[model samples]
Target: MTLVNNPSRTARAGVPRQARAGRPPRLSGRRLAPYLFILPAVVLFAVFKLYPIGWSFVLSLFKTVGGVDTFVGGENYSRLLQDPLFWTALKNTAIILVVQVPVMLALATGLAVAFDSTLLKGRSVFRLGFFLPMVTGLVAYGIVFSVLLNEEHGLVNWALSLVGVDHVPWLTDPLWAKVSLGIALTWHYTGYNAVILLARLQTIPRELYDAASVDGAGAWGAFRHVTLPGLRPAILLTTVLSTIGTLQIFDEPYVLTRGGPDNATLTIGVYLYQNAFVFFDFGYASAIAYALAVLIGILGLIQFRVLGDKK
Candidate 1:
């Protein structure tokens, strides 16, 4: 056989023949490469995001003492349902969310439009002035504001007095406390949000504005028809982010008023901190934290829905 067989025939004879499959599988080398590149990110997410979420969920369900946990099922959640402080926190948070977020977003939109239009001279300086408060520490700002809004000796009261106005107990009064915090928070973050929306605003085509102008659209008309629509996504994003931030507000209330006068500024975050850190009821705190997370998540979903419906 060795002497008689041709080269191809001899090679075929030496190899073991198997049953033929339908087709040889195609290896998606290019399609698969992206997944391989993203594997590190996936791993990190599993380790950090997923793992922590699981731990928090577990923590929310159990009572812990000296590092040992006793499973209590839905007890934590039930307790939250019955808690009046939780409702008060919810109401305060809701008020801030309703008022502060929209006002801040509106102001930010206006500032962004102004900055983007080149109407404002010394744009960099204006932006810096607006953004400076954001870089200032929250606790530091809270402390500063506490002093500035002090009922008796504060600059704000003195300034009001100069205009023949009465003293406002900004920290001690419930409504005034909300107002003061809202003002401070708005001042601190509106610029940051504006900068974000401004970046988005820049991405909108200048040609659209030019075309609108050609069609006899004035500034307001162009803005309403083109600029506003263009800003919907940015608006939705900022709204969701601001809602979450407001809902979980803590440091400002904590440092400025400590959830006074009589828990007027008692936000969910403050309440949670009080439960966990002050009273050392870790389970209840975890429950409140998770509830706030759920509330924020729901609000985000609602915003997304509204945005979609508009589309």
Candidate 2:
């Protein structure tokens, strides 16, 4: 029997050369199905996040005071720069960032290390307890903290009274109000960071610790050399996130102190909300929002510069 290859006959039989060669044809629209599945999320993010940000920037250029809405080229921004209240809010926010973030993250790291350590007992219970606070709603926690720190009757104040210390105004006094807010913020975020750091800690190779031990490196040395480097990425991410959150802090200040005691606890977020709803200066509020955004962006850049990979 003679078998001959014929191009015209093969073409009529409807098979491509690539198929005959045991190779598939070039991928087309079907290959893009995965992207297509995620298209809705991209569209939602553009609509909810990107569009609102762009609109807010445009709104910042307009003055909406009383019932009139008129474009006011950089006037609102100029006023923002000159506003002492803005400066106070900014200073308060800066203080929170500097003091609270490191303390919160350090606590979270300690919790993560203990939870991840073999010597630690009841790890599951402690891990759950660390993470439990995060499961509480922000507003609920804020209100709860307000009561727990009440000057005359709060559990904290009562305990202090039992120790012969006079009642400390946790919310009324300026410094105490800031301290109260810092404590609230730390409680709100530490558990979340601990969970993230614990995940990262678990990823670190146990052999590294063993090798360090063989080299006569103690726990502190192992932590300094092995653990820290492993957790850098997670730490940087949480630091940037904490910075942004502090810069935009509002709820605890608003709910706990109402940015009160002579605006001592005022934050950029609370101030922005005050302008928009209380004062009805939407334009000025927009400017504040944008300014906070810029601050957050700058701080994030600084963190990345300081902590990011060298190469």
Candidate 3:
């Protein structure tokens, strides 16, 4: 018998030499399905989010006059530096950030602790009630608050009068307007923060608390030693989020106070809205927007450094 080796016969009967040699196989439709599935989302994000962001930066470099855009380099940003209204708006936002965030977070932390307590009853009902404010429409809540906080005929003032307390000017005086805005903001967002903190609280090991109890730590001591340490990350997360939201506050101040009482409540976001929509200064508005973004970025970095885990 003659022994014959045929490459063609082997090729027809077995895997290709390249595949057998460990070369990667061509990707089939099944392998490419995920990318195809996400293609529409990628395209939409580019069109809606990425494009606007890029164009807004470009728009900031050009001054819009009489419906025509003229390149002005960094003049808009320079003008922002000189703009007193912008400074005032920044100041107001700082006040809110300083006052509102801590108060809201403190309240949220307390509420979270309360909700996490085994002694508390109707936990689900309370949680849902608290969370309902978060779902309420911004405009609707703002409108409701405007009515409730009105100085002359509002329910709050009426109650104050009945208690023989003077009717506080909730939204009229400059200082009082900021207070009212803070109150509204805290009421609207504290629940949301509480819910987040509660979720974080639930993840903490119950053994730690039991150990602390065995060590004769009281409720306050246990919370100080164990609960707070466990809650650090969640508190930091809430603080950063609250900072961003407070800095960019618009709808609440806009609808409730219209950044009124001599621009006392004018936040950066409201200022940006005014520049873009009210005055039609698209270039300056874009500049303000970017400046606000930079401010947020700086503050976020600072917060992470100050509050993030050391290790």
**Candidate 3 — what's its lDDT?**
0.93
Q: Tell me the deviation in Å of residue 40 in model 3.
A: 1.2
| Whole-structure CA lDDT of model 2 | 0.92
Cα lDDT tens digits, model 1, 145-229, are 9999999999999999999999999998988999998988998899999998998999999999999999999989999999998
Error of 3 at 4 (Å): 18
**Which tens-of-lDDT digit does each residue in 1-311 have in candidate 2?**
99999988878578766787899976679888888999999999999999998988888899865677899989999998899999999999999999999999999999899999889989999988878888898889999999999997899999998889999999999999999999999988998999999999999999999999999999999999999999999999899888988888888899999998899999999999999999988889989998888888998999999999878
Per-residue lDDT of 274 in model 2: 93
- Candidates ranked by lDDT, best first? 3, 2, 1
In model 1, the runs with Cα more than 4 Å from the true position are: 1-49, 64-68, 309-311
Better by TM-score, candidate 2 or 1: 2
Could you tell me the TM-score of candidate 2? 0.88
Clashing residue pairs in candidate 3 are: none
- Encode model 3's per-residue lDDT on 1-311: one tens digit a residue: 99899987777567755677798668789989999999999999999999999999999999977789999999999999899999999999999998888999999999999998889999899899988999999999999999999999899999999989998998999999988998898889999999999999999999999999999999999999998999999999999999999888899999988999889988899999999999999999999999999999999999999999989
- Which ten contiguous residues of candidate 1 have the minimum total lDDT? 14-23
Misplaced by over 4 Å in model 3 are: 1-26
Candidate 3, position 260, lDDT = 93
- Give all TM-scores, in the order shown: 0.84, 0.88, 0.92
